[model samples]
Target chain A: MDIDMSLVDWSRAQFALTAMYHWIFVPLTLGMTFMIAIMETIYVRTGKEEWKRITKFWGKLFGINFAIGVATGIILEFEFGTNWSNYSWFVGDIFGAPLAIEGIMAFFMESTFIAIMFFGWNKVSKKFHLTSTWLVAIGANLSALWILVANAWMQSPVGTVFNPDMARNEMVNFWEVLFSPVAINKFLHTISNGYVVSAIFIIGVSAWFLLKKRNIVFAKKSILVAATFGLVTSIFLALTGDGSAYEVAQKQPMKLAAMEGLYDGKTEAGLVVVGALTPGKEAGDDKDAYIFKIEVPKMLSWLGYRSGDAFVPGVNDLVYGNEEQGLISAEEKIERGKVAVQTLTEYKTAKDEGDMETLAQLSPLFDRETSEGQEFYENYFRYFGYGYLNAPGDIIPNVPMVFYSFHIMVGLGFFFILFFFLVLWFTVKNKIDSKKWLLRLSLLTMPLAFIASQAGWIVAEVGRQPWVIQDLMPTVAAVTRLDASAVQLTFVLFAIIFTTLLVAEISIMVKAIKTGPKENEGGK
Target chain B: MNRRNIFARVLFFYVDGFRNLSGWGKKLWIIILLKGIVIFVLMKLLFFPNVLNQNYDTDAERSNHVLETLTKSK
Candidate 1:
């Protein structure tokens, strides 16, 4: 049972590469569908041909994103079976449900109605066509729901039972998995980010049109719609984001600790407003964690636990154990986890050897249905991933990476809220054209939104370091045993393919926007 | 199939719609088609395989192997 460290690294790199590229298209699809649907709704209500033109114009762009998103998304799904087959087998019973539902239900609904939205304009009645458009929006967001639910389950790992005979977690209650607070918050926060991204994208392109003075009426209308949408969703994004962070504190304190670069426990933790980390800082080290910093007093405690004085354990506290805080050291957890592993192995060996008496004795330890078994599971099996760790330091994820990413994401979240408000104000006052600097500044939010979105994911995924399924499994063990070279080759292959596709997409998008929306038939 | 049939009419509607796509629509669609073929058909067939399903034909084998994975020492 020798582990290939290189294989794990390469496999992780490949999956991360595919996911980041796939995401570039997904958020747009998630939010743009709704925006387009709104425009089409307006068209039906007012019999305004211009609104229909706007819908069609955005729909074309949506079609472009939707296609590529499907392509990358398919690769990402298959990577589960390819790179993480073991993890798949472990949680696929639970994870597969949402994913399968996404494909069978949401995806089919989207694909079926998408054609009508595109080509059935004349064939279908206006109301039916509008319904199809709205359905596409709903379908796209629904797809995000199931995928995020699967992701949330990994972060929280609830509502599942360990089947001793099968040696994998199985879903015992679908409702717990679906409506878990973590899942709901993640889904809402993620889709709201999408809405903001779409709003920013539309506003940015529309601003460009205004700057060029090419599509005066079209651009102003677009900005009005997008700015209003952006402002509302940005507020919702912040609320859901708060809930997401609270869940992180409750479920993954280590991640929360890393995100804040906190190395010691604090009863009333101040959230870092901005900070520069001292390089080479590690858990339990005397090195100053931050070289310079600013923080809001007690904000972390309030955000994490909904109280000003709730104790928040940091990296050192979590690793070395905080006795006063009732935190167990990783060293102790590792010992218990090792016992869990060893006993399970002995049970399997005993069963294999037809030793029925030994099996009878060990069976109760693995059974959650019984009281003693529940105790074993809670006290030992819960830390099973720690059994594979070489040292307590292995429990600490890359702190600087998590700390910086979290800061950047929060900074931009506030900025976008302000930016959207100003954009909408300028639009309402009919001063958008006169504010050259503001229009230029508005263009920058699109790229900023992308960075903020990517940073949020970095905090979520990278902060959860070492574990693929929280405490249940470490990523090193979850990765498939494969030749490192094979994974390396595919990584390069995907990089090339995705880059080429992105370049082409940008070029096409630019060309379409420059061409402007199709004029009304015969100029109305 | 009769031209008057609903299915035939629906099929013709899409066929005609796609065939008459404007130049930009047609180009975006071409990229989609090329990407779909490469990602779904070529990439999946060549680069990726379901290791668990490919190697083990039965659930018993999979369960045993996974059980061994969980308990085995590095």
Candidate 2:
């Protein structure tokens, strides 16, 4: 059966579209819920009616973001079963566990507490209401935890052994899958990024209020909390980002190479602080990868290996093989992967035919308990996705996209730390209202937070392209063989529906912000 | 909070919340409702279905279908 490359492209586009849209709402929910919880805690402690009003106001915005997040989130999961059923079947045993756990967390925890947090205002005790708000925050972050665990498994598949008879990877140790270093780093990095985005969101909205000379007290207090949270989380974000880079260097060298636009292997490689990619740069070419570059010396090596002298492979090294570094070329992996694919089919055929002799011989090759099986699994079966590719170049992801997105995300991250510090300093000095330039910049920074968040995800996903589950399955092999037009149609429909929802959300949010917390009404 | 009583409180909590929404809340609720209908109702029911589960009843059958689909030359 010939592959419909168009179908593969459309499925990728649709999934990316849904994921990107879902993300816009999720960070706000993650960040704003905690901030709202903090505000409500102050109300409970101080017995202040004004703090309660502020909590209610921010909670209202959080609720608006949360609703759309739930809708888009469901669609993203279903896209797996619908469009990428091949990936669903291959790793479903391992992948579905996290998502199912996430569902339980979202339903039993987040939904239940969020209702009480939002609506049980006057009906519940102050402490109980505050506890409910905190639970909602924890529940939402836990949901992120499970999903990132699942995503991390795709980036660096572990704790699963492939069973030829079932034609799927089965989870062996649940703890190993859960606590994989990649999962921990990814979960922490992602949540902190959300916190930073949320802090920016709060500061921006408050800055707008300050600019208009409306709710001066409200805006200043919000900025104080947001800036403090932002500064702390921005530091956490950088630390986890370094941890993520280390994990990527170890488990996904191709992604690391793409991220840096590195073409030649090096010891003590410089981390590109700012650079432009040379036009039409390709791996193994004579052309230099960067047009002009400025880099922090030895940072890349130190980031990846904790040693400034450590060797770091690049695109050319990954593609063309480096025997000195024990790196097998993509071409060699494809050859071994072809044999593994063929042998799996033969083994299945033998088992079905009741060929006991052949089965006896082949069984050990799939069994990790056996030495032969361990070797075969490690060397060949590990490269199974490579068999699906037509050329060595197919192994490389969209390098320029990953490069630019990664740079943008990292550059903005450093800027945010300074931005938050300055915002807090100016506000603390009682000069926030007077600083019109800073106030306008704060308002403008909100969209940049959204961009940085989106760029971070783009770097993670696009940097690991071709493989849906790194070295286990390429996206071309993973996509369900639906007609191209069907996917195109659904993609358009989702585009329209999501756009409509986005518009409605913004309209409702702008109106809610314009209205501000009901000055006349309190604790209904 | 016993289980049934807690459940009842949540049920009424949501009901009362919906009942008491002011203009902005109601507008947001409308978007939520319309979007819920479009996504969970229309999209899930009409557009997207679990292909393997819908087509095959047993695990063995589903596995066989997926294996054939994946290992086949593209």
Whole-model lDDT per candidate: 0.88, 0.89
lDDT of 1: 0.88
Q: What is the per-residue lDDT of model 2 for residues A133-160, given as tens digits with 9 covering 90 to 100?
A: 9999999999899999999999999999
RMSD of each: 1.7, 1.6
Cα lDDT tens digits, model 1, A17-117, are 99898889989998999999999899999998888888888888888777656667878778888889888988857888888898886657755798888
On DockQ, the leading prediction is 1
Q: What DockQ does each listed candidate score?
A: 0.63, 0.62
List clashing residue pairs in candidate 2: none
